[model samples]
Target chain A: MLYEKKEAWSVLLRLYHWAFALSIVCLVVTGLYVHEPWTSTQLEAVRTFPMAYMRYLHFLAGFVFTAALMVRLYLLIFGNRQEKFWNAAPITPSNIVNFFKTILFYLYIGKKDHRLGHNALAFTIYVVVFLLAVCQIITGFYLLYPESVFWQGWGLKLFGTQQQARFLHHIFMWCFMLFAMIHVYLVVWNENVAPEGMISSIFSGDKFVEKS
Target chain B: MSRNLHLSDLNPTLDRRSFLKACTMAAAALGLSSEMVPQIVEAAASPQRPPVVWLHFQECTGCTEALLRASHPDIGRLILDIISLDYHETVMAAAGRQAETCLHDTITKYDGKFVCVVEGAIPTKDGGIYCKIGGRTALSILKEVAPKAAAIIAIGTCATYGGIQAAAPNPTGAVGVNSIIHDKPIVNISGCPPNPINFLGTVLHFLTFKRLPETDSLGRPLFAYGRKIHDHCERRAHFDEGRFVEKFGDEGHKKGYCLYKVGCKGPETYANCPAVRFNDVGVWPVSVGHGCVGCTEPNFWDTMTPFYERLPSVAIPGDRGVVSSAESAGKTILGVAAAAIGVHAAVGIGRRLGKGSSCCAKPAASTQASDDKSKE
Candidate 1:
């Protein structure tokens, strides 16, 4: 048997991945702090603005996350064939068959399968997470600027009230956290079980593959 | 002499100068200029005063009391000169059969020409028997009067969003006026006891414009309910500076710091309480060292409860009898996820060990094989 080293993720895709991950971490931490400030400053009120700083960081991270998502969306449309949305989350018959096979593999009932891009189930979850991120952005802007006529007319009408928007935003943060935990575990497991450099491929942009 | 009489003549308490001052003050409160004062005075002194039919149900009459305490023109002058209060159960000299006759006569005489002011929530459960006036259910009376009136003014949070009566476990199925009467244009003056200035401004806008004022999606006038209390709040600087009252009667409380930590819903409540104040005085809930209870928002009693806490506690549905804040819920879910991941990892390790050392060593062997093959 022969093996080959191949480019799996483009440089831009890897950049987007790390940027998105870092921003998500920053956003989650700052968002929780903004929601409920657990720390207080002993300095003069004029000298310190802990909550404001947390809120500022949260907003900054939110913008970064949005930018990262936009770049990823662009890659999904215009990147290499393997980075395309169809390859990542295709509903083709073969992909669908492999999705169930992958599930069975996870359940320890089937042989392990390797792929160059996201598995069908992982891609499906990514699509859902993408939608959640979009919701979070909309609700975030609504909370940030409640006086905006656009938000007042459209955001409020769609999301109900400010409190409702806040609730959705908070809930979506937890969803991201849940997804992150599982995502990390799955990738770690893949790195250990598969010949591919699953964990390092995201950072190094290359993976080992069996030669045809 | 009677035909040419002025507003001062009708109400002895108001003279020409003070009446002008009141009108000017009202113009300012309504976000109008001094030029609009004459129009306001004209509207107030109009010979054909717009008839108002006041109905109360499922409320404490605090809104009425707040209206009574309004002193820019005073309640006496407001009722006597500004608008013809033909039917109010609390202030009218008539009662029982006489009051009923007055209500019926006013509705008939001014049919489709008067403003119907609803001051409370209407109970709809079991035919709205919870509150009645003269053997007539409040629901029935509202349904009867609201159809004929030109417009409806839902006063107070009770009338705007069912208030406390419509809180969790609402037995009587209390609902706001807008929930019942959807045909007519409704202006919601929403608060525990809405500022009388907001009510007066709405009426003046209607009188000056010959229609109801522009309203938000919630049927609250945009002039008053357009901006959040936090935006116009006096202690907004403190909020920005991260100065908060940690508890009641703390040093921050005495120093008049922000009440964000003390469950002030001012950030969410869209009302001009901070700008307009209450009772013709320059003091609101926040100014007096208390948090805004978000009474102006819809379902405030339910959504903004546990008033001492910053965020509303998420209520678990069904009979689980568990109520937890969103933070706690998030933490709990995270904990469960962590535990599940831990158990899953442990089980995976255990299964690998059970399958003998070959399964565990397979990854390293495969990497070694791939490397050797690549070197071929």
Candidate 2:
């Protein structure tokens, strides 16, 4: 069978994807440690700085993730037609049907077909993940400065109290964790089964599609 | 204007020097410097003592009891010298029609000049019939008395946020003083029974300045309720070191570890309890072993319940079945992800094996055809 090399992602999209992934990984790891802080303290002389450092890392990654998301949204609005905002909306009848069809294919009940970009179900999940990311950014910043006058001025009053904001941020972190798990597993599975090199396409911006 | 005539003989222990010393101490408690001590003394020693009308409603009268129990300056000094305690149900000597007469007399006599100290939650349901004093409902009495007062001081958790009465399924529909009286400046000295120093500071601040001190968003005076209990707690080092008491009577608990795990609301609660200590014993709740119940926060009885649990269980919106604690919810999501990964791995191996067998047969057939073509 012959194969044709097609551009699957743009350079900016690929860069944003990797940067977002890295920042999310950093945030999740640092955020979890900051929440519970289960680490044993053998370093008694410098015990306070670990939690402080974890907080710093978590906040830095949060800002990075927020900036990447803003850039990704900007690209979605003005980038190629495939990456446009309209593609994110899966409201049409065929898109709805294809969403279920993709689910059925994943459950091994239908024939699989290679698509150019994100399939219907993946696109919908990506949209949800994006919204969750926005929530995480808001809640994370709210907790970061809970004691500041500005937070009490109008910030937390709009969202919630500091504890409630923390709860929401924790929930969003878990959502991102679950999303990453499912997303990575499916991407690897798609690359192995369909052999479109989906995982590499995120990095190289190209996928080998079957030439009919 | 005359200092000798102004000194009260009823309380012999409160002489001129002691009164001035108490004023200095009270001023210092109000976050004022020593320079303001003379002003406080002048305010207290003045012949025109501010009349304070103390109101009792749906409460156990713990606030009045706590105030009377304050030892640093003595309640006699606070009531007789600093301010005229006019009408308190618990402490007033008069009774029945005489007491009712006194309340009305004070209301009419002061008429927007006196301070109104409310000590309980006000019930608004069933025409506010849950609590009645002098044949009038608490709500009716508050509506009658609040507007005519110069300033309103909600002096307990009950008066601040409806306390335990305003918890889940409140039958009386109880609410704090601010809910009913919105026009007046209400200084909320909030706690189960707030530190008497906070009360003293507020009253003295008003007595000296002729105005209330700056308050927080919740109307708690910033001088006393400025910082969270956790910020200055004795076990803060334990919290920073992650040394938490996992259970009651455990080694960590005995060793004075942080009570964060066993539902210490100190991190979320704002109060000066850790700084002042109840009854001047150098011990607060956490110092003794129990965690803070967050009684200072609004609606804490409902919001900060399951007192032994780390975090409250969140109710998911639009879904009645999935009430989950934060820990359980996180575990459930992670468990589902792990199970999904396992299932996906099994399916992937099965699919790969099925494809392997079919592709093996095709490759064998192709080799035979290629061999035939080469031999020809």
Best by lDDT: 1
Please, what is the whole-model Cα lDDT of each candidate in the order they appear?
Answer: 0.78, 0.76
Find the candidate with the highest DockQ and give its number: 1
TM-scores across all candidates?
Answer: 0.53, 0.53
Candidate 2 residue lDDT tens string, B191-223: 988887788888888888989989999999998
Model 2 segments beyond 4 Å from truth? A1-212, B1-12, B15-21, B71-76, B312-376
| Residue pairs clashing, model 2 | none
Per-residue lDDT of B292 in model 2: 92
Fnat, 2 decimals, each candidate: 0.03, 0.00
Task: Report DockQ per prediction, comma-separated.
Answer: 0.04, 0.03
lDDT of 1 by residue, B1-376 (tens): 0123354356565567656766676688678888888898898888888999999999999999888755443533665578889999889999889999999999999999999999999999999999988899999999999999999999999999999999989899999998998898999999989888788888888998898888899988888898888779999866664567989999989989888788888877899989878777678889999998888999988888888888443211211111112223434544543454355345445544654646454463344333323322
Candidate 1: tens digits of C-alpha lDDT, residues A1-212 = 77777767766678778878998999999889877777754532432456656666676567667666776776676454566677757488878887888899988898876687788878888899989888887898788667679877766877989999999899999999999999999998877777688788888777888888
